[model samples]
Target chain A: MALVGNLRDLKLPNLIQLNCMERNSAKLTIEHAGKYGMIYFHEGQVVHAEFDPDIGEKALFRLLGLPEGKFKVENGVRAPMSTISTHWNNLLLEGLHQLDTMHASGEGKDRRLLEMFMSVKGVRRAAIITREGEIKKGDFQDDKEFALQALSFYEAEKISGLLKKEKSQFITLVTQSKRIILTEYDKDIIYLDIEAKYQLETILPFIEQVLI
Target chain B: MINRWLKEITDIAGVEGVLLVSDNGHIIEKIGTQLDQGTLEQIARRILRIITAHNLDEKSVKEIELICYNYRILAMSAKTFTIITFCGSIRALSLLRITVNVVVGHLIEDKKSMKQIGKYTGQPEIVLEKEYLDQLEIKLISKLQ
Candidate 1:
């Protein structure tokens, strides 16, 4: 029933304590820089969460796994150092994996990629646009065109039209440094740019089978 | 009257075709060039499924439209209907939106006319036979698969 202070001043234990003390439905929204995580408390229990993919009590247990009392609780606000750093590398890998799947499916709509990115812990905003100067999909509406222009270096329209047409579901152009993802489905086109340096060469062939 | 009306719609929208379909995916009237009735029916059914599965409610559903790019599909939806238009990689959203609005208005008018026909005739009994339903179902499923 009480409004807790900013999320940055409290830790996991204090958050749990607040849930029990209030004994009411509450939403804990953590905003660091621009990234956000929302945890839902229902009647003194953690019932839902938006950040930790694990969901429910399992996410609570993960949060509690951190060193006890390591988190500072100030005026009912819990602030843990960099939630992204705590799970940085894992999030990066997941982001890469999502990019891979999107590329493989040739379904790099900015919206779908944004959904995947939002599911991760670190990334705040992102988008994918085809090389043809069109916004495919993304989270923030305004930034979509900017990201597409940045990735394409502003020549997306001309370059995308040059790719060969095929019935393969997806058309990919791969190199040692980066990869281009594109797909045609249900009368629309999607595409993306992905860093190829860290991914296995074998991944492209696998994607071809599933996507194309 | 229906064919003439559909042609008028094509003139307004510059689309290749227009279709009148039932909620269950039956194609009642198909008009336009370079488009087969079967293909239009199949596309309609798939679009309906996409709208339903995504829980994309009416408020957020913009006009029903689809634009094809070289590598992806962009789908737009409206209440009770959808349109799938193919666009090459270079099509702009601004142009697509204008085109779709024209088509949407035509669709609304078409739906009204169909209702008026039923009311005027007093038959009000428009039912696809079981055989036609079965055939449509099979065709739709195969197209999706």
Candidate 2:
């Protein structure tokens, strides 16, 4: 039989620690917002992970960041492949540390950054959104469309991992309805709506300034 | 001839690889020997799906530049094909954009390339499944004491 529960009730780190201390080989699968992530433990050590468009350590970090989800743990289920070699203790610590950093820098900082984005000349609107497309703050009339545009960052983040590149600085898209500029700030996606008359390049410096 | 056009983009500094994928996710042409064919195909398919999921295709998004810390992925769309580039340390993106424009122009006008693209016009795209996770579960269950 498998252990199944919600992440809201039991945080992932606690679950990871529980499995590790028990020295059980298990597979913990998490489903959030229609996406699935898996972590495989072999004798108390994390051996593998799989998240859509990500595997190995990258997948582990992403899984760790999930705030809420449904999780299942099947005991004695060995990993098909081992994509991680870090000790469980170290892995857990690192994952938790990254989460802490994101939250610490995220909350109060987003509003200031959004205001800075709006200050840029030729900027029509600015919004800050979570990775799951939730609008944390924005003034856009069509919030749904705005959130959808920000979702484009997920592909960039995935591709960057595949290419072994650094974190993305910004993404610019020229779509039919709007000219958009997007950046990752404190784990939140900050996007801007630009006027048709303003050249994107000319507006980049301001965006860069706010990022700095 | 298509590979030759793609090579122009790969030849640029910081560019690791380039793939010209059809609308339905077929790799019409590619350059950069460092990345394997399977990896390139998967990347192409993933990007195409993302484009469709976000309705970027319907929005007529002409150009997209995903600028990362140490690398970049640039995609330029023509009506029939999209050029996806994996680049490292992009120091001259303007030059790369120009090169892509020229190459895409050539592809649009090239009769042979257009004919090849037409073959894949109505083909269904490959969708990914998560059967590996389930298979692992079954294998482990069978091994239970």
Candidate 3:
């Protein structure tokens, strides 16, 4: 029988434990938003795992951090290879610890940067959004909508990478009524909006100054 | 009128050529110098890539400017058409922008003329300038002698 449930109900560690106790050879898959990951098990021991280009312990750790997702385990599946050697219990503990450390490292810094963006003269809304269109922190009421629409700008950012002679420069989009600026802040992506008439010339220097 | 406007744009001090491409990738009209089919194709492809990457659906795109070392290309939508202009130097930057703005304004607001953007009955015609030059030449020659 396939085990199926939301990751919220059965956390990754608990799911791994369930598989381990049964000594089930299976491939467990989890998906959140648009990203997917797979873990291969040999008789209930995690032998391999992947999330895109990341593999082994790193992939496992990332998968561990997903607070909510849909997960499925197909029993009797073959393990592709052995990439994880750490015992599942110890690995889960370490992964959780690492995620906690990562969150703690970024906690206050991102809020301060968002505050900095909102302090700008023409800025009306400031947000720390992920590449996947998740707004971690925002000053706007419709932050989710803004983040979703601003995700289109990622395509622009990538395209600009191919088009710009100054590859290192950040990308900004100006339309008739609005200016959307994207920049790196506190290891997270910062997105801010200002009126179209506001000068883009002043943004970079101000951001750099505030960052310093 | 678009042909004449194209000429006006190409005549901008350092412009190399003017090409008006439709959203469908068709060249609606072309005027001026030094542009070849291959170069135009490359430019079209580059612009298309930019449009795609920017998530700008055709018809929604209002304007685009691509600046390179030797040249600058400006493209703007005019209903079903997108006008593109290529100029040679950074020296033409201000003039080019102003001219493009004027042309776009004319394209949008004054779609009245078949040969010009609008009907301007009072526009002055000055076809003969040889006499004015002749007076200047005579005065300069007299001073020299």
Candidate 4:
């Protein structure tokens, strides 16, 4: 749906456009009616996003879960004002359920799971990637690729560890201006790696929450 | 063997020193060059106090692998032991990761050594004035370090 009002009249779109134009690194919290979404902007690019219920990587995957090839961004020049309210909330709840499972399994502290949690929390839009040779949204079209690309190398490693019935030795998630990497090591010390380019601002808060 | 492992870890991360600490902030074994045993002990004590005051459960504290700013302090845990690494601010993430990984592996494999070290160096077992403990707890939870 066309954003119901002029870009200037919509607080979210205006803030997003302004931030995108200035290349600011900050978190934007947007609420419409009772639904809420947060978009993190880094260097004027929309790198990470979330809505009322979902906050980090889970948010991105949920967006990926949208029918393959059916995913389309209408009015790429202007943000959608239709408020994907139900979709966003559903994703948030789903993300929370996943988090609860991880926490209960004694795996909440796993860096990869934590990164996924951060990427999905409060997110509603696809990440904007500007890095060269970096995999972004197209990877989300395939579930496996999406999982590998969206998580850090450390997270992939953790998954591999679980797959092999090995104890996870270590997990690490590192984000720079251009990329997010997750790495996991098995108790026997094999490594798994994943990488993607998105804005760091959107992901930092989630990381902080997980770490702190 | 402990010295050899510490040397390997320092080589990996450019770590200045490493220490084994109890959850209560007692120092067990410390190794490396140009070490600040006193200051490091104080920092470890402060970290424990901070962890306790914040009411951070075991799960929450285990998630913090590294804390970096002006200087870098890396925390890794295995059951009852916490391994703390001190490094210069300029250390790279990869280097830090390798160092933490090697030390953590070695620590896990050498639990007996850690316990023996703990026995010899026996934590200072300080008894803080009640008011001092309260003030420190307040400062720890409220301030960012």
Candidate 5:
């Protein structure tokens, strides 16, 4: 009988490791997003693979990219052709490395975007916080204190409703020590601490540029 | 006297309402406000908490300006009270700040306002509860009756 289960229960990477370690000759089929991908293992070695329009290493990486799918492994199924020559261990490592690089680039983009804000004159500190209050980018001595600033925005949102006002866009707090600005950025909150010496109006236009 | 002082802020164009809250979250005085007593009280509590949290790090907060889509809310803290004003536009803030300074100055010297503020002095220590901080918005708004 073929081993079958959802990829969610048994991830593709783990499944590949299992088949290769067992030293079994089998063909593993994966169905994801209406597409079918197959990997051929020859006695503990990843000999061949195919995932439509891509075969061998390219197909393997593409398959690894899938977050969820259904997979079936049939024993004694042989590959009609072998296209991958790299060792299975090295292949898996490369695929995972590529995934990590892709994720890091996304985070890097957000960090660079914050750099754009920090570049503004008088912006002493800056951070992007998600709705759950996690700091997505930027740095602060106390993340807890910074996340609490979102409370002001939340209160303002409620107050706006009672006043029958439009949706909230941002909040600016001018304290004795510093001026703090909190604005919405793609569902996340951008917190900026500005020096009291600089007039808020003077730097607002430049800050708005980064927000947009 | 404090009411008259607060009136100067409400008199500004686009200024909707103003609330003078005591240091311990009491509504000492309010002028030209559309919010009911419940909503104002809730806001006062939140303001106190926000100020307290910021001050925990030893940073004294003197003012805060919240800008919504069509409204702006400004909170300014003085020796005795925190003044929260709801306005219709951002432009009103520049004018409000000048007017507020005048009001804060007068309150500091006025014996009557000082005595009234004394009643709420010695603010109780605020315990930062995670549950309270987490439910900042939806819970408070839902409680609005």
Candidate 6:
């Protein structure tokens, strides 16, 4: 039988641990946003893994950064070749270590982007999401991790050409709960956090003023 | 250590190649897809210029990623070496970040790499300064006295 679930509830470590304890030959497929990776277990030991074009420990460390994603394990699936040799415990520890380091310094804040968000009203949370897959938050107050992921999946990758061709400034998201605004800010998307009630027009002038 | 880092970083899905460059335009090491020494020097010069331009901004020179239509470049600076990777296409940020941090960790944590960094920095430079000339002149005068 195959076991599958979201990464939010079952972290990668637990998933790996459970599979290891079961002593099963399996292939664990991890999905985050739209990207996917596979980890192969031979008799409860992680013998090989891949998130191509990454393989082995490099892929493992890269996959560990997905704070939220999905994972499924297929029993009896085998690895084509072994690419990892370290103990699972040591690998997990090292992967987590790399993840923490990347999180701390990967995305850097641009003051102008922060100032633009601060000058606007009803802005709950904001991040300068880059084309290179980084989120530099405007403030420390709100956790917009989910919103950031959705925005990154859609706006950061697909509409990049659209924004540039038209020279458009930003896009607004109005949902039942909140409003998120996106704009071009120095080769990155400005994911502006706004209250649900506030109209897009209300923040337009402030955005134009500060961004200019 | 540099060889191991190059090997690991190239293992990333879209990473095509990596070059460890010294500040004064030396290719300390190159792995994966090969680039001519001229092209490598050009890139190294540009990286040096950009880092120097943004030198004042706190942490501005730490990491620089340039995305283009065909390929991408990601560069991170250590104490003496700048690690640059050529990517097939830009993907999620985490992959690049992980690769960068891991390479930087190797650049710092490895005893051999640290020693190599010192050796790399010890290369001769032609830069001359008035202060150094004055100091040399004074020493000469003292010897004459």
**Winner by lDDT:** 5
Poorly placed runs, candidate 5 (over 4 Å): A1-104, A131-133, A161-164, B90-92, B124-145
List pairs with backbone clashes in candidate 6: A53-B12, A53-B13, A54-B13, A133-B93
Docking class of 4: incorrect
- Pick the winner on DockQ between candidates 2 and 6: 2
Can you give the TM-score per candidate against the true fold? 0.32, 0.60, 0.43, 0.41, 0.63, 0.37
lDDT value for model 3 = 0.60
Local error of candidate 5 at residue A109 (angstroms):
2.9
Model 4: lDDT of residue A8 = 29
Tell me the alpha-carbon RMSD of every candidate: 17.0, 21.4, 20.1, 18.1, 16.6, 21.3
* A14-124 per-residue lDDT for model 4 (tens digits): 444556676665555443222344555455566666654554554443333221111112233333222233333354456556555655754443434333333343322
In order, the Cα lDDT scores of the candidates are 0.41, 0.74, 0.60, 0.43, 0.75, 0.62
Give the 10-residue window scoring lowest on summed lDDT in candidate 5 chain B: B136-145
A111-144: candidate 3 lDDT, tens digit per residue: 5455445445566677877655557887555533
- The TM-score of chain B in candidate 2 is 0.77
What is candidate 1's local distance difference test score? 0.41
Which stretches of model 1 miss by more than 4 angstroms?
A1-212, B1-15, B33-35, B55-68, B71-81, B84-93, B106-145
DockQ of 2: 0.21
Cα RMSD over interface residues, candidate 6: 20.2
Clashes of 1: 27
- In model 3, how large is the Cα lDDT of residue B88? 63
Q: Per-residue alpha-carbon lDDT of model 1 for B58-126, expressed as tens digits?
A: 113232222122432233344444444434453344554555566556656776655633333321112
Can you list the residue pairs that collide in candidate 5? none
Chain B: TM-scores of all predictions: 0.47, 0.77, 0.62, 0.66, 0.83, 0.75
Could you tell which candidate, 4 or 5, scores higher by lDDT?
5
Of 1 and 5, the candidate ranking higher by DockQ: 5
Model 6 segments beyond 4 Å from truth? A1-212, B56-60, B122-145
